[model samples]
Target: MTGNTNSIENAGDPPRRDQSEPRRVHITRGLVDVLLELAEENEPSEMNVVLDATPASSFDATFDLDPETPILTHFYLPSAGQSVRKVFGVDLGTPAGRGRARFLTHPQGPFKLTERDDFAAVVLLAVPPWDDDTLGAFDRSGRKLELVVVDAEPPVEEL
Candidate 1:
């Protein structure tokens, strides 16, 4: 006398994963434009922006740009277990007699004068996972942009 135990549980339901877990998120140029619009509206002194490596991956990160120090900070790469380089330079073309000069560049730092009306913007380039063959096959750079507004006030502490 065997009882039937072969019935499937929630067969029609989609698989569920923990929402709190750090998952990969795709950040497209269009999404960046939407974020820019949102940032323009609020103009928060400081804000925290997070980016996921993919949709179902365990790579998550955050970036911050401080206007007070006028420096970019709090860049985390969990997968790498460290923070990335803060400053970078680019060639801006040389003068008639001047040699090739490098312009101070902080791609993930404060926004340029032209990019904002009242708020400064920070641009970050996120490289995709090197181990991801599928992603690497299409795009070697795997660059994504993340923007955060620096906050004016400090966080309150609980005593």
Candidate 2:
């Protein structure tokens, strides 16, 4: 018991963590870098600018695309619902993808992320069954694009 306290050999008993788990989590820092890189290559605009967001519950937003930027989409948490999901957005003059937006925390949402918008962060989503999608640059004309997916098969109408 006279060895270094930080010794890996000791490997003190692990502490128990809270039972809470994230429903819809954001991309990790490592993945974020890769995402940005992909976004950069397609850079929807000539300006070197990064966008910041504070996503809200039951909310939707649009991002203006630049010519040289790239974008992607994806979905996780297989236990959610079985909806014919789809991602919608401007097609940057190239029909690489489409623009569709839906709530991530719906009773019929694509992922089992109900009651947990706090941990949700925006990232590229995948198409239905594929569970993820990605796009490069915004549509031409600088029009804002929205991300759309089906939370439920029939799509729960937002009140």
Candidate 3:
């Protein structure tokens, strides 16, 4: 892999782990609180966040997963005008089906690997109808990527 080669390879791919490996979103209670606070402020619409996914250390005796686990930890609020498309730098901000706008979807559809996926880990999507927030992970190439959800320790102090 060369300089740009790595970036190109990462596009449309997970940042830390192989697509074939299992995944679990390790977010902190504080992160969830912040997201909820943003949602409440914005009231319904959607707030999308892009974050770097890194491998988290595990110490559970019963914890059994390959070391290749990629933890999606993107948890933050977007600025006044920032958007996923703008951040990703693809398409012309085209909205998806059902008149809902601003969803992070691959313009060419999933599994279409590019340099972007290699670097970008995941986009935290917060939409209305937030009740059913859990969706089992899936590969962009269309395979069932199993997921595990755990409340992680806050990455930062709650000053």
Name the top TM-score candidate.
3
Tens-digit per-residue lDDT, 1-159, candidate 2: 576655676577575445353222222233334334543443332211222222322223333333222222222222223242323432232213322222221223233222333221232322122223432112222222344332212112346
Tens-place lDDT per residue, model 3, 1-159, is 676745766888766656556644444344455554655565534344443333454423223445455444443334523465578764333322211111132322232233453222333333343322522233444344443554664243245
Q: Which stretches of candidate 1 lie over 4 Å from their true place?
A: 1-26, 55-109, 112-159
Residue range 98-117, candidate 1, lDDT tens digits: 21111112123332322332
Candidate 1: how large is its RMSD?
19.1
Worst 10 residues of 2 by lDDT: 98-107
lDDT of 1 at 151: 25
| Candidate 2 wrongly placed segments (more than 4 Å) | 1-24, 45-159
In model 1, what is the error at residue 81, expressed in angstroms?
Answer: 24
Best by lDDT: 3
* TM-score of candidate 2 to 2 decimals: 0.17
After TM-score superposition, the amount by which residue 150's alpha carbon in candidate 3 deviates from its true location, in angstroms, is: 1.3
For candidate 1, the per-residue lDDT at 111 reads 27
lDDT of each: 0.27, 0.29, 0.41
